[model samples]
Target: MIFIDYLENVELISCGFDHNFSITNKGEIYSWGLNSCGQLGLGDERNRNTPCLVSFPNDDLIDIRIKDIVAGNYHSIFLFENGQLWGFGSNRDGELGLGDKNNRSNLTKIPIENVQKIACSKFHLFSLAHDGSSYYAWGSTKYGNWLSSRKLDGQPASFSAASAMILESPITFGLTSKIKVFQFQEPISTKSIIRLFNNPDNYDVKFVIGDRRILACKCYLKSVSDYYCLMFSGAWKEKVEVEIRDYSYETYYAYLRMLHYGCIGINQNRITQLIDLATCYIDKRLMKHCKTFIRDDLDEQTMPTYLPLVIKYEIKELYDKLSHITIEQVLPKVTDSILQNNENSIEFLDWFYNQRRPFIPK
Candidate 1:
């Protein structure tokens, strides 16, 4: 296999009809293969079997760091770190977005800014603004130059339009102002929500665990657990401080962190305690997350330890999965004494051996 070892740490690659382009982590652009229409952006219409460095036209090459590269049938587009776009190669249908039907042998900056993303077809190009709400389309209208806008809920609206002629420049298209546009509040991510955990800034509730106290948000806790929802809404609506007696500070802290950060902050050693806390609060989502971790950690070595816990919690899925473990897998590592000490393990062995006794000779 041909290895291009010189192009180390390549961050992105794009391929055209016959040409290819690559961008390195150091913001360097390289191109090779067919350059019949100057798609290689090498300042000349010469094909290159080996990769060559792509240079900008102006003397400010040092500041022209490329963020992304995309290639069409015979054209190429480059997005810069400053959110500006540049293009080269075939422009028969203005696919280069250069505002003219002329092929460019070198990189030429297009009249667009704050472009977060760029995509192209054989004869059309599309760009998304950094705002993430605005979209633009340009190039051959015969190949359908149009943009369809969806509602904030991701449902398609009954609004779509197509241009009749070639688009020499990028044009903004979406639902007209007359149409109702749903303006939904930006959803908070778990990563962002987790930042508020144990933060005293905007806490509406406090949990006193022995000598320690933890600040928390009522709205967040209410959303995750039915027990918290009822407790906070019914009797403790105005209560700012509540005492936790059943669980240790570590377990309760981990439980709150799990509510905010999912299972990412869960400690493997404290999973059993977390499961108990989840069960006490009747938090099925948290229980499911704990079960998933247990299932993924279940194997020959862990089977003996986790089997009883699985049965205690009535985790039928895990119990059924453990029932399928081969004797070969257990006998090699697990000893008879280890299996005999736990009644659950002994019972599992009895069931397993009885099921396969017909196949075993006397």
Candidate 2:
């Protein structure tokens, strides 16, 4: 993922997934083992064995060739060609300028003016420009200070471009004549997070439920909504077809109204059509709720309500399994009360509790 350009003039002298090392076209060097304190000047703390190349192009902020890299606990800095300054990787204390003590993994060009030099300490940095101006600084540390131009004595370490000299990493421009360490870093979000267990698909699987006999028959129910308005009632029992006198329209609008507004308005004779649609899914959740509604009132006219329609359609194994539990539990005090007893209910509950779990065992 780390791509290098004009690298033909480069060589892979070293690597430090957690360290540093660098080499040049002529096999020059710029390195130390893991720079836990940016002491290696590789712009970051990390150790490396073999040497690595650290040169970047001179014009681009990033592609500029690097003289060396260094790391501080919370900052890193880079020295560039033409006396140009660039830094980042960490600036929790203004180790980098353009004024905020912000850390940047990517190389950032510092906005300090003139021919220059910079240096870094554990959490402080110093810079010196062509004018020989100096700066003092702190924070992301808790200390707050500044440099020359006494009139600007109490400015934000990065407030004035002229008074900004702090860098996260200390860049040795050419020895003792280095910049002062007053630059501080800006804030960044490093919130701790538990990134795992964020997705359900990572554990998606099937789940099964309920009696099989009635459930199986429920699947065979044909939806009248599937019918068209041909108005020819053919003998479904045989292969005979019937013709119509006039093209009659099926009141499909009733079905549409039911779909769009959740209101089933089909007339009495047409009730079956919409009822089939409403209960077509044969959902266990729906059936669970239906248990109460089925016991509300008993009237022969409410055939669609109290009929054993679904029960008769259930799977034999599940029906038989459920049947073992008498009517006292399935429908105590109701028409099927005598069919299931309380003891059977207790046994069924026990069986349910003993079934294998449907989810991955936690």
- Candidate with top lDDT is 1
All predictions: root-mean-square deviation over Cα? 23.8, 31.4
lDDT of 1 by residue, 1-362 (tens): 02234565454566666777766657777899889889899989999998899887765546767655667778888877678888888776666666667889988877777765555543334322221333455555534532221112232111122221224443424211110011112322344686678897778889999999888899988886789899998888998899999888987876676566443223345567767887888877667767876775565545665777788888887866686564555453366645567876777689878998777566
In lDDT terms, how accurate is model 1? 0.63
Q: What is the alpha-carbon lDDT of model 2 when measured against the actual structure? A: 0.35
Q: Could you tell me every candidate's TM-score relative to the true structure?
A: 0.40, 0.28
Q: Go through the candidates in order and give each one's C-alpha lDDT.
A: 0.63, 0.35
TM-score of 1: 0.40
Off by over 4 Å in 2: 1-49, 55-74, 122-362
User: Which regions of candidate 1 are displaced past 4 Å?
Assistant: 59-61, 122-131, 143-362
Native-to-model Cα distance after best TM-score fit, residue 224 in candidate 2, in Å: 99
Model 2 C-alpha lDDT per residue in residues 1-362, reported as the tens digit of each score? 02222222233222322443344435344554554444344455565454443443355554444433334334445555455666544454454654664455445666654423333343234332331223333332222422221122343322223224233333423222111111012211121111111223331111112211001111111221222211112232222222322211232333332222222222223433333434553433323323322332222223343355445434232333244333323344343333456666676567678785466676
Q: Candidate 2 at 267: error in angstroms?
A: 99
